[model samples]
Target: MEKHGAETYGELNADVYDEWHDIDPTDAVAFLAQLVEEGPAGPVLELAVGTGRVTIPLAAEGIDLRGVDASEAMVARMRAKPGGDRIPVTIGDMADVDPGTDDRFAMVFVVFSTFFFLMTQEEQVRCFANAARRLLPGGRFVLECPTPDVARYDREQRVEAHQVGVDHVRLTTVRHDPVGQRFLGQHVLITNNGIRLAPAFMRYAWPSELDLMARLAGLESVGRWGGWRGEPFTGEGNYVTVYEKPATPAS
Candidate 1:
């Protein structure tokens, strides 16, 4: 993958990003609803809310929600959705956040493995700290990432294409130097009247590495899961970590 790949992805895939982004939209809502009820309530902030898969649904439940995304194109797509305009969304880097206003949330979340885009340990830790500052004391922060099952991946760079119906999805998974991880993304909806592609680039993180980041941000892990349904976490499973900001300093 080129250095500018992620910057160009949103513009390149805007159209299909609207069409197929919520492949499992309903099930996702069900899970988020469960999260809302089981965890904190009231105001919530959604990080990297690409096209509002979880935010829009959660907003419909009448929860006070604000969304943040780095992509203008993706934000635009979210605006066209059923409850889009009802929520306020900011456009900015997920790592830096949109940089200010004193509002906080009961919960802050990064979904669909969005956390990996930070690409560095420092940036990932910074994001946790930023989210912590945006929460009320004792608020929860949740992040989901695909476990870095480096074995299922290949060492060499590759460009592969997949299709969901007439929508053709192309992917480019390039292995970066230093022998650590891979970049995998799909370009969807190619055969329609003009094609739109959604390119996702993720640098997988081991569960232990992420736990440390959360710890440094003054957040502690309360739970880890294999999926959105809250399955137990493991080496081969996906990760859903729930961390809470201590009511006072960690000391």
Candidate 2:
């Protein structure tokens, strides 16, 4: 297995990320905009805000939002986009850096399985703690991640062709470790010119584990949905969860 960290994904995929992973942001943007509008009074922060996919759009909608990303390469791409420069951004590890002592957000969010990029239980817990510390009392931390599906692996490994075109083909290969709840995978893109590989590692947590992490960070589970549209979660493949810090005055 190759050794890498949070920045690896952006470093490898930044150039082609927006082009290859483009998804209509209308629904997600609308959902999050409403959340921010209804929540406490403060700016919003997004972790791993690569290419400003969701962040840029939200900012356009008049949300006061800031972003933090580990990769300068990714941040640069976001900076080049229109209105991207208006949104404050920090280049640091989301799990460890303080956005600002004076700045507190009403909402913090990690979307599109970015939570799994932390790659270990310890890092993930620290991420939750960091989010909590950056939020105002009664603030919300929202995470969107795919529910673990070990069944997709056969003999602990699986490979599937993701895309096929006349000049290019994309394939995904994954190796799972049940005990550690980790998925080590690589995306292979083969073109007429050559081949490119983008590797990824994730330490997945069960819903119960997520709840415990939130509790440790002084947050309580407030909502869980199967999708961004507020569909009820029923052990689905992907889900969104919201955790809120208590509004009670600190003793």
Specify the highest-lDDT model's number.
2
lDDT for residue 104 in candidate 1, whole number 0-100: 69
Residue-level lDDT of model 1, residues 151-183, one tens digit each, is 544554455544445444444444543344546
Model 1's TM-score against the true structure: 0.83
lDDT of each: 0.71, 0.88
Write down the RMSD of all candidates, one decimal each: 3.3, 1.5
Instruction: State in Å the error of residue 192, model 1.
Output: 11
Give the poorly placed runs of model 1, Cα more than 4 Å off.
1-7, 18-21, 27-31, 34-42, 158-160, 164-173, 176-199
The stretch of ten residues in a row with the least summed lDDT in candidate 2 is 93-102
TM match of model 2 to true structure: 0.95
Q: Against the true structure, whose TM-score is highest? A: 2
> Model 1: how far is 110 from its true place, Å?
0.7
Give the TM-score of each candidate.
0.83, 0.95
| Global CA lDDT computed for model 2 | 0.88
